[model samples]
Target: MEYKWIDNFIDGLIDVYGTKDIYELYDSLEISIRKLPKCNILLQGNEAFYNRNFLNKEVVFIRDDLNMEYEKFILCHELGHAIIHTNIITSAFSRNLLNLNKLEKQANYFALKLMDLNMDEIAFEGFTIEQIANSFNLPVKCLKLLLDSKNQNI
Candidate 1:
């Protein structure tokens, strides 16, 4: 089933924050929930405990120990789940390792939406990397990388 939360988030950002761009919305989300502790453990290929979960809880547990973009994305990915996918996730599903479920997919989709963007001149006139950097307040490189990759997906 389609997650309306994602669309709701976009619409709410547009309505309340007056934000029409994806990165700007994500940056707004980051600003709204900015104090999430950064902590990361790379169990990526290990697959032992690839991630953690808090059902219906909007919290971010970023593994700051690792500095890789993937870890950052993982943190944001979990945040995406918390924001957009937790409502549909069932109690039984939350109990075990069903890492590749639909909710997880939706979370990944949210992450992808947040990360992938195109800053066109008509859309973002006089929008420079420096301005985007200032707006999101992320490093130019990080923001640029996120904006550049429009073909990636969950």
Candidate 2:
């Protein structure tokens, strides 16, 4: 379950694209982004999804109701599937399971690394993980996953 490769992949992408800005990365990679209303049942209560159409064009559909910060994280998560999962179509729905599957963890890790939040540095400055998550408008669970991954040296 080690995911250092995800970090490496993101690093290579940053090196090639010259930016960690998710929107900029999507633009440079020719990925289309669409915003959908919360009433859209197509998502099945998910926040977002990623897929390649019959024409093989990559696209991400996000819920327009999310706040700016959460929206960015959702976009980054879907972009993870676009880059990491590649051929696999994926969604960002809530899973009731305690343990996340590999793909979900990988996508979450990708979102964390892509954001380049410097969590360790921030933690060094005396901020609790919850506080950090709140300041960044990220879910505490997601931030905890990132911290756990780092703790494991992954």
Candidate 3:
């Protein structure tokens, strides 16, 4: 599925929060990811963390117990929400009521871009899907999404 919103938001992010690097981009946007103890009550049993508008700013609360790989992915995903969904923060409607699948997929795309992930960095000729995912510290499912998006672009 094509999501025009992703392109528009990415353009806006590049224009508004452009920086010398990804770390600077995050800083320029004032996006922070804080690690907290794992608690099911916090985000209603979500796997990792959650983002919210706090004091007119965007904040991500990630589980401290998550492994480094999960940490990287979750941080990127929440950052995506902060950048791509900033405008909707003031809306009364719940994001869960929206096309959540599309939103999640868009966030995945946003994350990969922010990470500067290059498929060329990984060898695929003889590697299994699981091997590729493990080598790159990525979830296989998300890797598939990234590959699919890349294929579509090509």
Instruction: Write down the RMSD of all candidates, one decimal each.
Output: 9.1, 4.0, 3.3
Per-model CA lDDT versus the true structure: 0.49, 0.82, 0.68
lDDT of 3: 0.68
Ranking according to TM-score, highest score first: 2, 3, 1
* Candidate 1: C-alpha lDDT: 0.49
Q: Please say which candidate is ahead in TM-score: 1 or 2.
A: 2
Q: For each candidate, what TM-score against the reference?
A: 0.41, 0.82, 0.76
Question: CA lDDT of 111 in candidate 1?
Answer: 52
For residues 50-88, what per-residue lDDT tens digits would candidate 3 score against the true structure?
456666666676777877766677777777777676555
Worst ten-residue run, lDDT, model 1? 43-52
- lDDT winner among the candidates? 2
Candidate 2 lDDT at 118 equals 67
Q: What is the lDDT of residue 130 in candidate 3?
A: 86
Show the lowest summed lDDT stretch of 10 residues, model 2.
89-98
What's the lDDT for candidate 2? 0.82
Which portions of model 2 show Cα errors greater than 4 Å? Answer: 54-56, 89-100, 120-129
lDDT of 2 by residue, 1-154 (tens): 5887888899899999999888999999999888899778756678888767726887888898999989989999988877887655333443443234777778988998888776568445888878888988898988998888777888
Is 1 or 3 the stronger prediction by TM-score? 3
